[model samples]
Target: MQRELIDGVPVLWAETPGPLEATLVFGCGVRDETFRTLGVTHLVEHLAMSTLPRLHFDHNASVDLALTQFTCTGRPEQVADFLERVCSALCALPLERIEREAGVLEAEGSGVADPTTAELLSIRYGTAGVGLASFGGPGPDRIPVEAVQDTVARFFHAQNAALVLTGAPPAGLRLPLPAGERPARATGQPVRQAGPAWQQAQVPGPGLALSCDLNDQAVFLAVQLLRQRLTEAVRHREGLTYDVGGDVVFVAPGRGERTICMEAREGQEQRVTELLWQEALRLATEEAPEAELAEEVEAAREVLLDPRAVEYELMEAAAELVLGDAPMRGRARLDLIEKLTPARLREAFAAALGSALLVVPCDIEVRPRRADGTELPQFSCGQGGELPTVGESSARP
Candidate 1:
């Protein structure tokens, strides 16, 4: 069913027909608070993300520059226990640099950690608007520890919180909310069809420069097709790696555009950058048989179905709503995947190519080269390691 009103925080609960693994996952997200507070939220999430390593259960949290998130997974009986603790942490964690927590916080924030593949990609993508240096966005070391503290002091609103329970929940286990009535828009989210955007991303990694080109609806579709094709060629066909995929998100929020990519065997570092680009180009320029599309779409469906395993199920459909109010469900997303007919897909690619943003996740320095193989070195990094440092990693201490 649908319910809302614990002093404004929206709560969504659903009972799906499936054997839940007796666990729950609650995700809390908030977009772009101060850089400092954002950092603190990261620290807070770390403080709570635990699963008794041995029990082999799942409990983790993440705070992105655009959003702060937390997820807890455990048996049904632990629902109340989990909820209480989570809420308590929400209410108690002091954003202030308390003397006791200082050592812990400093130690955590000071130590540096190797960049994840994703982090490497983020570093390459966070560029400025003028198409120049770092755009001061999230990257390997963009957000620092103080930024975490600053963000919480300013934006950590309780009402902005949400509690989602999927599996069997505790009887009457509700989030502690104030007395005022909740707004109507609180219960469910409204979804839109498309957004405005154009760009590409190049993530710095060792090997070939990997990039992502973004466009409108058509280009978005082409990107998805290219992702699947490459996954087939490099991953399944060549067994270079296990999985390979990318995303073309047509964000309608204030009309923004973004694309993401995943590769097999670290394709980002290969001299095969040209081949990868060619493959992406092919998705936009060439056409694939109907049978191939069918196979990949089926694979996509399987991915959509995997979440059924999580006891605390959050329909990705809904998350999209919260972020951008976009509905890619029912016939919408299906139509997107299906409508990328080879002929039409290429048209979409050509158009998007003009204003595309390329982000390749590799250490390969990008050299602008003409079709004739002439190298262009006009572009340069306005700065190096342009990320804000948050904290030192400590195995979750």
Candidate 2:
């Protein structure tokens, strides 16, 4: 892998011997938009790619809390052409179809009440920054053409962007970007809360959700280990849950949230929550066995070594660069994982549990409360009732 500047835009090129894959990643997404202007970046993304001619390749665009990415995979020439077309479309977005695009966005937003990430973040951080996921995209009709165009010019630029290629750089792949500086990282105004707090979500069946501030690789490994334990105890041993897993959401540099979830059987919500917390507390008290840690380390190393992982790392590196942080190389990451001891991981797990927030099924009354005996906050929306005001009864200490 090599880094260079192409037309003033940072580019990370990897000459891997595999199918060609290229992504144009920018430092703009949900975090860049305000509450009133929410979904502007997504709207722009939709408009920017609307004009691309169909090519025999896999191409798509996605928006997250802090990054927007356009990716294509196919023959080198095909990938290169698609990327160029995407850049051109971004530079000259067609606003004439604003109404049509707005309708499309509204339809997309109407299907789901709220994304799980958004719900969890709203409970932990509130409806700002990463928490805005709880707030559906501002309808296309509400966003002005000028705001969309201005966002494009400010964030989708040469300086705030990176091009990643899995094979070789494409010939004549010029990124026609306007001059602009990278926007600053978006910050979340997290709601103040004490830990082991519980919230409710409207969903079929029951599940247990947990969130904690991400500190380091040790915490990451701890989460992975905890997930494995929960799966074994909840799904295999007890047959109480059918699916149990977790994911990490990075809100900003050195700040992230990890969620562990379990989908429970009917009438088993209380048991599932109990088992989930049992696993967390066990991990906090006892160190993970050396063999279990080794297995996780090996699995992680395999993923990092895979050729396809380069594409993921490329985007991650670009996001890290935009956030003013250096991306950890694969070897360095493995080294950190390798050196992680059971005692260290236990400490990390305990710390995570100290600040963790738990979300359970809404129908189940007499649910688990916070460890400190504080009342657990409930997340109510249009379906549940009126939304709670900030720092209201739903807010925890």
lDDT of 1 by residue, 37-90 (tens): 323444555544432233334555554323445555556545555555555555
Q: In angstroms, give how far residue 190 of model 1 lies from its true place.
A: 26
Candidate 1 wrong stretches, greater than 4 Å:
17-38, 47-58, 74-77, 94-150, 167-169, 177-221, 235-270, 304-324, 359-378, 381-397
The candidate that wins on TM-score is: 2
- TM-score to true structure, per model: 0.62, 0.86
Model 1 reaches what TM-score against the true structure? 0.62
* Alpha carbon deviation, residue 395, candidate 2 (Å): 33
RMSD per candidate (Å) reads 10.2, 5.8
lDDT of 2 by residue, 118-201 (tens): 566767766677777667655668998889878987898888888888866777777887788767665565674646556677
Clashes in each model (backbone N, CA, C under 3 Å)? Answer: 48, 0
Clashing pairs in 2: none
